[model samples]
Target: MRIPQIRLESTKAQIGLKTINAVNNIKQPKADLSIEQPKAELTIRTTPSKLTIDQTQARADVDLKSVVKRMEEFSQKGYQDLLAGIARRAQQGIELMKIENGGNPIATQAKQNSQKPMKEFGLGFIPSHGSVKISYEPARVDIEVAPNKPKIHVNVNKPIMEYEPGKVEVSLKQKNELNIDFEMIDIKA
Candidate 1:
């Protein structure tokens, strides 16, 4: 029997920063400056698998400690910005789904038109003065049945930000069915 290979793909993973307001900036005579950093955290969980087979046979988990370290080196704003962007995108998806689900065309059109710009507003920007951008390559994983092994790869893209602090984490999992090949024989020759 031969085992087939399985592979899965995921969209680019991104993390966002939270807005940091400058409270008080003090400079000592020695050219040392002290500022207050905001306390904000963002947590993002991928949607659970909808398939019953997947729910029982497949599982994937991410280590928050490692993710936090990567995020710390990657983005200061943390995960808030990414969450906001995802939320906006999800809202857009829900609206579109409603339109496709036999909702009123005229009302859907009107809602879409009114919501487009508002959705864009959710992705706030930052100034470049004191803001930092952190990015990481996308992460991928492959599973093979013949070898009964799983391979993982991590890559980070360049982080882009104007002037905010944020963080991001990504995870993925998949299931596959194995097919066996056989030849049919004549029953009564």
Candidate 2:
């Protein structure tokens, strides 16, 4: 009888792997878009306003204090002249009427007495005083007028405004990492 020898063996483990290759298309997309509202500033400056008004009335006053006295003097002078003319005309008319009524009485007596021419006798024929000219001057009066002026004033005011916009900030993402995994194709041969 032949005796068989016993043997023991151990095998090492093996792994099959594939490669990893890729292009990272990195684009920092317009750094987190953000916006802020606009703001406005106002400034006001002023000048003090003032106004003044003045009024004047036109007037023309008549001072009639001495008018009466002056008119009276003129009236008195006219009256005197008129009266003198009337008296003179009246006397002349009376004398002429008397002479007309008593016509040729003295001539009849002279013819009866002597038939020849008698001595000259004077008749009552008195002449007037003087040949005067009458004046007809009237009185005078006057009035005056004056004017006045008015004043005016003016004032003004103004306003101003200013506008501005807020600022914008930009930033990017901080940290990142990559990972991978592996496995065996065949086992237990």
| Top-scoring candidate (TM-score) | 2
Tens digit of per-residue lDDT, candidate 1, span 37-139: 4444444444433322222111112223355565784685557768887886787677667776776766655665577463444443333222333334444
Error of 1 at 104 (Å): 9.9
Candidate 2 scores a C-alpha RMSD against the true structure in Å of: 25.7
> lDDT of candidate 1?
0.47
Candidate 2 lDDT at 104 equals 60
Instruction: Write model 2 residue lDDT over 135-161, tens digit each, in one string.
Output: 444443343333333333333223333
List candidate 1 segments past 4 Å from native.
Answer: 1-78, 100-189
TM-score of each: 0.16, 0.18
lDDT of each: 0.47, 0.44
Give me the candidate number with maximum lDDT.
1
